[model samples]
Target: MAVNLAHFALNADDIPTSRAFYEKVFGWSFVPWGPPGFYHIRTGAEDAPVQGALQQRRELIAGRRTIAPECTFTVEDVEATARAVVAAGGRILMDRFTISGVGHLIFFEDPAGNAIGAMQSDADAE
Candidate 1:
């Protein structure tokens, strides 16, 4: 049996800001896909569940919007990943948090100022 990660999403406070950030930093391109909160961004064919949209958030985002927006990435170690993020000049929003007892996670911003996250299962050791 084959299993894989596919078709995931990330929320953007403002399409324009997120779009430009991704383009400049990650070289990802965005194209209109569905409705107002929909976009198709160019991404790698790796395990990344793909960014379907950077839609406008209705929650507080970087003092911009007010949407509980988040982007999830498969990581080996949440703490190590977070540490690497800080070493690379990325700011960690929260130290480490839990969600529904599923796993541990942390949020951070990209070089272009786009917020993203890294997550690891609860079974993962520190």
Candidate 2:
């Protein structure tokens, strides 16, 4: 038998802010899943990709803020993707580097200053 995980939620200090950061960083979409303050974020993949997330926490109260970098993102192609993220207004937090036998990786800050990562599989690094 096989099991699949649908979505993951992070405690965001500010949902809208987190949403905007993620959307800009990963090109995802967010939708409501509950009351006014509760929401779901969907990460996009594979050209017209779809994903989902549920969120709730002590952040974002219509002007007040509490969100921070809350996740990790992996990509098969890191070089081009890093360039694209920058072109779209995001900043790479670190230069790409090898991680022992893991492969090449880089960390970046989203438009909202949330830390995120991008990686290239070992097979693709060669």
The candidate that achieves the highest lDDT relative to the unseen native structure: 1
**Candidate 1 steric clashes:** 8
lDDT of 2 by residue, 2-116 (tens): 2233233466656688778878887777778646666666656558544355465643233434354234456766787689879989888777877555568776666876656
TM-score of each: 0.49, 0.42
TM-score for candidate 1: 0.49
**Residue 31 alpha-carbon offset, candidate 1, angstroms:** 27
Point to the candidate with the largest TM-score.
1
Model 1 per-residue lDDT tens digits across residues 1-126: 222232346666577887888899988888887577678777876684364557766432356553444566767678888888889988887677875545776777767666676777665434
What are the candidates' C-alpha RMSDs? 9.3, 12.2
Q: Give the Cα lDDT of each candidate.
A: 0.67, 0.62
Q: What value does the lDDT take at residue 90 in candidate 2? A: 88
After superposition, candidate 1 runs with Cα above 4 Å error: 1-61, 66-70, 123-126
